[model samples]
Target: MFTLNSQSSVGHNRARTMPTSSAPRLLFLCFTLLSHFHSSVATPRHLRLSVQDIATVEAAQPARHRAKAKTTFFEVDRPLHPPRGSSGPCSTLLLSHSFALTLTKPPVTTAYSPPSCLRGAGDVSLAVLEWRADCHGVQYDRIFGVWLGGAELLRGSTAEPRPGGVTWSVHKDVTKYTSLLATGNSTLAVYLGNLIDDTYNGIYYANLTLHLYFHRKAQSAPTPAASAPADLIVPVSRSQPLDDGLWFVVQNGTDVESTRVTVPANAYRAVLEVYVSSHYSDEFWYMNTPDQNGPFREVTVQLDGDVVGAVWPFPVIYTGGINPLIWRPITSIGSFNLPTYDIELTPFLGKLLDNKEHEVGFAVTNAQNSWYVNANLHLWLDPKASTTAGGLISHDAPKLAGGINSHSLDGIDGEYRATASRNISATGWVSSSRGNITTTFAQRLNFANTNVVSKNGSEQTINQTIDAHTEVGGGGAYAHQLHHSFPLYIFLGGNGSGTSSQRLMRKVQIGFVESRSGAVAGTSTLRNEQVAEAVVVLRDDQVAGASWRMHQVYNYGASNGACYVRNVTSVGYDVLFDHDEASCGGTARR
Candidate 1:
């Protein structure tokens, strides 16, 4: 859907609110730091078929024929890195088999049972989850999540379907949830909210499988200590709601989504894993008018009433974002599998070890309309102590620095700039089985954004960048360090002709770079870049002609000699060129 009208109105109002002076620098600071912290594949044929017709055809065809006809669309990314060498013996468990998901139906729920071969096996080394889905007809992109024992294991978005139908699969490394999967009679749930109406009639058919790999007696390499999974996993989410996602919706900056949790008395380490997505008014938060709070938003984590950490989220564009035509075969970087953030909560474990319930909350600093948020608490237990004691020694978190400034504005044509930075640190000591261990956590984040609106709002451009670093050390544990950066540039404009003969154009360049080291996970680096452009001829809001082109390059490497590189280019729905390599050389320089 085109949103030029809303954007133009927002720009006009922002200009009216600006000072009449001719100065080039007009600062508008609104910083409240309460927070802690804080794919393509497939064929070239074009066929028009209804949802039911496609399903009937598939049912009537032979299994081999159906497999040959189905086309899979996916994002280019590295595959899950399981233990090298022979992974001992492996067993596959079916979580769901071709389950139909719709708006009126409840989530698919099934009881999980450990494979008979691993009924009492304790050498399970890795667990991987595979999800596959197919849809036809016309439908909007929808969000979905998978949960085991009420703890979320995967959160993703469905691809928008076409008339010819599309199929895709996602493979995720779930080794961190080994403890949860081992529990007997645990409930497994999958939820995908879809609509079936006159205009949109696509129904999502999904299948989920879990693979468990046991470690061989003689291993080629040892698992890192930092890679050790949590002993006890806790859900920091809504209780009694196993039918749908436990995510909480926040409408504004004042809205707080929180849950009370009580950790085990013997727990010595804690970390919160958060998942978030924006929708409705905040979908294009990067282009929001500067006078209307600008385009800066942060997610804050709070322990009880104190801010513990904060997260400046990566602007993940969904499949249907902007012009949907550009994402036909190749979707955005995080469109299929949204990335999750980790916040070290070990510093606040002392306050939670009193055998009492404490609140863990999340909020968006400048949120608007709607945003879904949830988290999981991972706790490590001390085997030698039935109970542990610790205290928070120091916590230094200040308000956000920098804010929005209006450089120039004239009748919906103006320039706006925004910048912000934050630093947070915390230290604590715990007396556990390993003696008195002291731990410290530190994080730094920087952000910059510029928005230019010209030609009476017909021409709009945005440039934004975010850099962040985090570290955790002490307690004789290997130091953990993580660095990441997100750079985005977008240009949306239209020919200054009349509405009937107008031509709209859009260009986008986005990158996601991340590196992690120390701990058991070893060292790893990932770089993903995408450049896309689209042009459409619209007459009275009806598309008359359209064309799109996209190019993407992905590179990933690890200290264990695991390297993967892929480059792909596409025009419209046809893949022009696709290449794959196993070399990671020179990836760090990009």
Candidate 2:
């Protein structure tokens, strides 16, 4: 069964008055929480603000303007890092041309062949995939996925379009799929499930390409002794493109989407990568009404009939989520590029290598409707052994431990607090050519959410946070370790009694932090924080006067001497300042 876990006190904190200054007090609070993780490191001086600076910023606030729709849309996310100077020339291949997507059409399928220039290349230093799309007219945000040889490579969502048009692009690092790309001839599929009608007339047109950067100097062959990427990728999805998507849909908590597969007898290591998205009534799951389910959900992974792992997804708000005015040009984190979860499956390799088909399943605990779920099983084959033997040493996964407290004067106006947590661990040993390798996996997850509604349901506030830590070890060496934190806060309210001459206000502060270290992938840290506040006046269901402020900071650093820091502030569709730095120097500047 799926479970939830979290740590925090439960209670409703009185709402504070929204700050009127440019330097929002909520931004300071968010920075305070982020500072705890950088205690051992030096935080950029510019990131710290003083009273005088706050006053200066407040004094420079621009005057409110009549809110009007815009034709163009974009985000402040930084572009992908370019190839290093040492890396030689790069080759680009067009994977898909202009492809139109709609609910009446099936997945766009095509054959993929490696570029002739890369056939004799010594080695690839890096590989990147880029997707560009454009749309116009009215439509709701839609989810899409890309697959190569049946293995899902990317999962993302489209931006809500305006009357004129909107265009956006996403770039992703795909070096992990080097083996898959080297295949002789493989089928590539792109699916975007969308509807087109008289009211919703938007259609998505997309293009995709792949770039491979070759190593400047010939590199030595990879050694077979150390733990490396999987040798085979098996898709746990539909076999043929008979529908709009290869993923299975789960409508309720008990629904399970599964697939059967067989692995090679020589496999010694395995990992499952999952992609999930909630839609319909569950799209805003974080703020759902609290009940027996406690306003928390978990995507569970099953081996045969037993639960093995679970994913506590982040709350990603699409462009059309809540009030569209708040996200005009600044989409929420994880909105364009949805995050994927990984589950270490080495402990179950023994059962998967029996030369027989086994079932791999997915389900969402306390789910409502319209959740698309699928996975890819990556298996590492022994280089010198024809068959491998292993056995499960121990397994322990307790059910979630927590509950919800609801206090309400009326059903529509009340406060709800929920908390949950889970601790899981497993150990196993495999005998291969490299020797008897023991693998251990452990995970600790926690979640907490508080919802408050008042003024006869005209106002609502939600504060939620999730913390997760995972570790995978082989023998005495750590293979991988990751720590992630998700913090989200939202306040929605309306002023005036009537629909006309009323004003709507929204305040949101969302952030994601990730730190990873181990032998397999190296060490890296990334943090992205966004804060936005907007007020829109409505006259006859149309925007009249409007004002908004958005501030975002993205910081990333890797052991390979890669660093990217960018900070942006915008007001009323006009960017106040944008600061970018490629080096890990001192602090940023305004």
lDDT of each: 0.72, 0.69
lDDT of 2 by residue, 491-532 (tens): 877798464677767788999899999875579999999999
Poorest lDDT segment (10 consecutive residues) of candidate 2: 5-14
- Residue 88 displacement in candidate 1 (angstroms): 6.2
lDDT of 1 at 137: 68
The global Cα lDDT (0 to 1) of model 1 is: 0.72
TM-score of each: 0.85, 0.83
Error of 1 at 557 (Å): 2.0
Angstrom error at residue 322, model 2: 1.7
Tens-digit per-residue lDDT, 405-457, candidate 1: 66443445667678989999999877887778888888899999988777765
In model 1, the Cα lDDT at residue 77 comes to 78
Enumerate clash totals for all models, in the order shown. Answer: 12, 9
